[model samples]
Target: MEEQRPCLNKAEKGCEGPVEGRPSYAGTGTLIWRCTAHDNKAYEAAQETRTRYPDSSTPPGWFDPAAAGERWDDEY
Candidate 1:
């Protein structure tokens, strides 16, 4: 049987879904896995945070603001 990985956002979002998208990297370069729902949510959140705090550090488990031009598909 294929291994099933739980969503990384389970604690924050109370999600019970398996990871459904490619893995992504956090600003700290940590690998993250999420379900499709949380993946989109995180991407949107990162964009908003980058817009609001252009000179500040990105939140944990988010992509670096400097890498805004990078796509998730290109990472893995």
Candidate 2:
């Protein structure tokens, strides 16, 4: 039997939130999983990176500020 791995986020509050899987854009059927909080953090980081590198393009699934407060779950 395969044992499921625990959430990677080690928050003191213990967030064992639902595991979310986002499709990889690498033309593969690989799905990456992360807790909700970490997912939000990842999206925020993407947004920041896009801002810092305005001329560069972010990969698919990155948070788009022009969407105006649209949460990331909608895209993923």
Candidate 3:
């Protein structure tokens, strides 16, 4: 199976999705990532996994210097 990318929404909380891309927030022109939205339960589960498996390799979706500040043209 193909390896999956982990989410990069590492604010006060974490997530379980790929970093779709950086796009300008509607109307504000502020650059933001188009992330996968998860429900409360999914969020909790992801947090648990991350905490329990702290030594895991970095996910593909995690931020990299090469892709920093780049825009994702398509997100859906």
What is the C-alpha local distance difference test score of each model?
0.57, 0.49, 0.41
Candidate 3 Cα misplacement greater than 4 A, ranges: 1-8, 38-76
Question: Between which residue pairs do clashes occur in model 2?
Answer: none
Score residue 69 of candidate 2 by CA lDDT.
23
Q: lDDT by residue for model 1 over 1-76, one digit each (tens)?
A: 8767777666666564567645443354545667766777777876776676676543445654433323433433
RMSD of each: 7.6, 9.9, 14.3
Total residue pair clashes for candidate 2: 0
* Candidate ordering by TM-score (highest first): 1, 2, 3
Model 3 whole-model lDDT (C-alpha atoms): 0.41
Better of 1 and 2 by lDDT: 1
Residue 74 C-alpha lDDT in model 2: 35
| lDDT string, candidate 2, 1-76, tens digits | 8546444454423455776665422223445455676656655665675566655444445445433222333333
lDDT of 3 at 4: 43
User: For model 3, where is the 10-residue window of minimal lDDT?
Assistant: 65-74
